[model samples]
Target: MTEFQILVVAAAFIVAGIAKGAIGIGLPPIAVGIMTLAVPLDDALAIMAIPTLTTNVWQAIYGRGLLRLFRRFWTLALTATIALVVVAATLGKLGSAQASAWLGVMLVVYSTIALLAWRPRVSRQTERWMNPLMGIASGAVAGITGIAAVPFLPYMQSLDINKDDLVQALGILFIFLIGALTFALFRQGAFDTANTIGGLAAIVPTSIGVWLGQKSRDALSPEMFRRVFLIGLLGLGLHMARGLL
Candidate 1:
C-alpha cells in the first residue's frame, strides 16, 4: 500500500474512534467513508472488522447492565446476526448503490425524528413483537450497506432505557453487527494480508482517538452531544442520498 493510503486509513480510524468514544457510535460509518476515499470499499470494510469488534466488546462489557441488555434485546441481536449473514452473501447480487440509498433514507428519517423529539414510545407488550422486527430491518440494512446505525440506533434510543445503558446497549448491538459483518466479508474473500495488517495498525490511532473522545464525553452533556451528532447524521444522509440523484 502507498504511504498516502496508509495515512488516510490511520486518520480515518482516529476520527472514527473519537466519535465512538464520545457517542458510542460513528466508528464504522466514518472509518469506512473516509477510508473508501483512498481504498477500495471492500478493503476498507475488511480493515474495519477487528478494531470495530474489539472496541465495541469493551464498550458492551464495561458497563454493569450487559446481562440485562442481552436478555432484553437478544431477539433483536439474533435476528440481526442471521439476517446480516444472508444479506452479505447476496450483496454481490444486489446493487450496492441501491442499498446505500436506502441507508440514506433511513438516516434522514432517524435524524429528523431525533431532532424533532418525536418519540414513538413502545409499550412493553408491543416491544416483544417490535424488537425482532427492528432487528430484521436493521440487519438487512447493515448486510447491504454496511451500516447498522439507522433504524437500530434510533429504535434503541426510543426505548425507555437510561443514558448509560443506552450507550452500553449500542455497544452490545454493534458487537453482534460487526462480528456478522466480518464473517460475511471473509466469506466473500475480501481480506488480503496488507489490509489485514493495516487493520491491526489502525488500532493504535483508533485507541488514541477513543481515549480523547471519552474524555470529552465525560465533560459534555451526552444529550447535547447526541443532538449535535444527529444533525451531523442528517448532513451525512444528504450526501449519501446524492447517489440516488
Candidate 2:
C-alpha cells in the first residue's frame, strides 16, 4: 500500500472504531466504505475481520462478566454466527461488489423500518424464538455482505436491555460474526500480502478511536445515540447504493 493509502485506512479505522465503541455498532459498514476507496473491497473486508472481532471481543468481555451472559445467550449467538459463516463460505469468489450492493439494500431497508417504529415491543417468549431466527437471517446477511447489524437491531431494542448490556451483547455477537468471517475469508484466500499489511496498519487508529468513543459514551443518552446511529446507517446505505448503482 502506498503511504497515502495507509493513512486513509488508519483514519477510517479510527472513525469506525469510535463509532463502534460509542454506538456498539457501525464499524464494518463505515470502515469498509472508507477502506474500499483505498484498497480492494475484498481486502478491506479481510483486513476488517480481525479488528472488528477484536473490538467486539473487548466489548463482550471488558467490564461485563461473561459467565453470566454467556450462559444466557451463548447458544443463540454461536448458532447465528456459525450459520452466517457457512453461508459466506458457500458464496466464496463472487467478489465484494455484489456483496456490497446487497448490503447497501439491506441497510437501507432495515434502518428505515427501525427509524419509523416507536415503542416496538416483543414478548420474552417470542424473543426466545426470534433470537435464533434473527441469528439465521443475520448470518445470511453477514456472510453475503459482511454487515449483519440490521437483523439483530430490532431484537436487541425490543429486549429493553440497558445500555451496557446492549453494548455487551452486540460486542459478543459481532465477535462471533467477525471470527467466523475471518476464518471464511482465509479459507477463500481473500488475504494477500498488501491487504494483510494494510489491515495491520489500521489497528493503531482503530484502537484509539475505540478509546475515544468509550470516553464519550456517557455524555450522550442511549436514545440520542441510537437516533444518530440510525441516521448514519441511512446515510451509509444511500452512499453505498449510489456507488453500487
Against the hidden true structure, what lDDT does model 1 obtain? 0.81
Per-residue lDDT tens digits for candidate 2, residues 1-245, read: 78887887887898788777686677887788677667766787888876777677778887655777666567668777788778977876324777777766777877787678744777767777777787887777778877676667666777856777777777777777787777778888888887877677677889998788777787776456657767877777777677566
TM-score of 1: 0.87
Q: What does candidate 1's lDDT look like per residue over 1-245, in tens digits?
A: 89899999998898788778787777887787667668766788889888888888888998899999999999999999999999889765222566556656666776787688776677778889998999999889888877787688778877888888988888898999898988888888878899899888888999998998889899987677667767876787777677788
Q: Candidate 1: where is the Cα deviation over 4 Å? A: 93-117, 219-233
Task: List the RMSD of every prediction in angstroms.
Answer: 2.5, 2.6
The estimated TM-scores of all candidates read 0.87, 0.86
Worst 10 residues of 2 by lDDT: 92-101
The alpha-carbon deviation from the true structure for residue 86 of candidate 2, after best TM-score superposition, in angstroms, is 2.3
